[model samples]
Target: MPEAIHTLRVALPPEAVWDFVKDMNKWAPMLTGYQKHTIVTETKSLWTLKGDVGILSRTVELEVNITEWAGPDRVRFTLTGLNEAVSGEGQFEIRAIAVAGSAAAAAAASAPVAAKAELSWWQKLVERFARWFLGRQGGGQAALPAAPRAAVTAGSELAFTLMMEAGGPTAPLVNAMLEPALIPATEDLAQRIVTHLEKQHGLG
Candidate 1:
């Protein structure tokens, strides 16, 4: 089985995050390689995704069933492959956290004054190279906003946990191929959700 867990800090209340995540329709398309989805009922849906598995690319259909919906806290769901032998489960969790916005702002305000120095030639060259490499890795995606600069506020921590495994005669081989894709897919979905919500709030 391949499992991935990603957590992000959002400068918003847990209730706000829950309001967005409670509706799957809003974030389902944020999944990497998402094609389409159909809602069958409140607790069930079907999804189509096209993605690369090792050197081969294919489309898979999955049946998603919500097992629990704990508002302002968590959403747990199970996945069953409709057109293939695969099954998985995942969840989204959000919790409140204290954000020291003023303290951080104060630190940032003093950073330039305390470190007004020029970088050496090699340092400048390395910095430029690092930026270029990071830009390429980002794929030009919209960057998330910086943390809020308001007074101490109530923030939320969002986590997405996923576990997937393939079945059938070729289970081992398929799992090997699937393992490499899980983390990237999980990260893409989770970060996109945070980006969307953060942009909507835009306190930063």
Candidate 2:
């Protein structure tokens, strides 16, 4: 099996990060190659990912399950191909760099980021989908609070990793090819989380 592990540090606190990842739908569409996902239940979801299969673009169906939720720290998941011969395990790990808020009140906050450029079409689509799937309330989505307490601040590290293997004679070639794609996906995951948290906390 080949593994891809990537990490990113964001200004948001662990609590805020945890809040976002715990609800898979909030970030699922942000996934690279993401097409759509349907929650079969709370822990299981059917996902369709669009990516290149050799030289041809293809959509692959995957059945994913959330195996564990170590809140404010990690989420473990396992997935298998529904239409192809592949299987993988992945996890999102979160750790606080500094805890500033009282334990009773959970400590973490982010500074306001400068306004960003207009989003790409897919960005707009994903945002719209997330808002619709999670619902929207005026300028902000009806997900988390508009802003966390200004008095709190906690730095956090968010990481993602996956180990996967393709079955068959071309498995090695496929794995080698996938190596490059995972890095970009991981970066996308990090940026997506950071941007969403900042927006959630009214930081823009």
Candidate 3:
């Protein structure tokens, strides 16, 4: 089977970007295929996704294992289908944008302070669970965290890659079916997440 990769660049600091991407509990629901996801353990999770193959859409369950967990930078995981005929690996990468001595860089470097929000009920619930289980709460108060001031450099980019193998050999069909919904959803979610970040931080 072939792999399908999608990349999206968000204007945020590398660390901030990493923080958002590494936290599955916070961002997994943003994915187009996601129905629901639950953390099973420190490095394991169960995900329910809607398999929207142009011809049909059905819910599927997957067990995911964290294969790589590096700090403020990257995440890699392999997923096994629990009730579907697909399996694959995915990864997210973040990096700091190098700013040259330009007016834009200077302005960005000195951008006004970003605002923060109080935690929402759901966020509080997640925080409470984390506190009980992991002994600590992640960022966010009543709302989500704000994007870092440092924007991705002019040429810097953030990329996401998803590779899946199916029992059958209809790779092209599968890719075609998933791409339309997947791409738009990914972009939409990314925008929403960023908007939420801005609202939380008083940027917007």
Candidate 4:
């Protein structure tokens, strides 16, 4: 499948970054053409996003399923276009930033481990378990993966990716026609996320 991947360095601990991003409600609006999103259930969501297909601008609802919930590290999900019949998958990965010897050793003292993130923390934990069990039941071994959560002594790096495919005979044409919009959206993912997170700290 065709995929778009973008990565950026975030000036916070991996745990802090994961706590913020694990909740879709907090991060969905960060999409380039995002309009709105609703969490229908713990693992399911309905998202309305906008983009232009050539000269015709389109808005569509997407059915999203969280396939993997690796806390403070990675998350993977798949989406289906409810009205248009397109399907795709995406992932968010966080890796610890590397630094010099003393700088790396001192980095752990800078950020709070949990930081009073009580509201959505439990939801993510529940996601980790639910996705695991569900993935196991319905032949989901490939779909649901347990991402390792290791301690990060330095800042973190965030990466986002998305893959889209038209679910019908016209997939090629659809992908070709939608290439312009898809490219920008995919490229914008990382910058938007970084800017959003940085703004929370009053940074540029």
Cα RMSDs of all predictions?
11.4, 13.1, 15.3, 13.1
What would the per-residue lDDT of candidate 4 be over residues 1-204, giving only the tens digit for each residue? 445565566556688789888988887877877999999888899999987666787898899999999988999999999988788998888987532223323232222222111225587587567757876784442221212343333556677777777767888878766656665676576667666765675434
Residue 164 in candidate 3 has what lDDT?
Answer: 62
Q: Which ten residues in a row have the lowest lDDT in candidate 2?
A: 107-116
Best candidate, TM-score = 1
Q: Residue 142, candidate 2: how far off, in angstroms?
A: 37
| Candidate 4: segments with Cα more than 4 A from true spot | 99-153
Task: Give the clashing pairs for model 3.
Answer: 115-201, 118-141, 118-142, 118-143, 119-141, 119-142, 119-143, 120-142
Question: Which pairs in model 4 have colliding backbones?
Answer: none
* Prediction 2 global C-alpha lDDT: 0.68
Instruction: Return the TM-score for each candidate structure.
Output: 0.75, 0.70, 0.62, 0.70
- Name the candidate that leads on lDDT: 1
Alpha-carbon runs more than 4 Å astray in model 3: 98-156, 169-176, 179-181, 185-189
Q: Write the per-residue lDDT of candidate 2 for residues 41-156, one digit (tens) a residue.
A: 98899999985555666688999999997898999999899998878889998887542343322212222111111345577677667767775443332332224453445667
Candidate 3 at residue 10, lDDT?
38
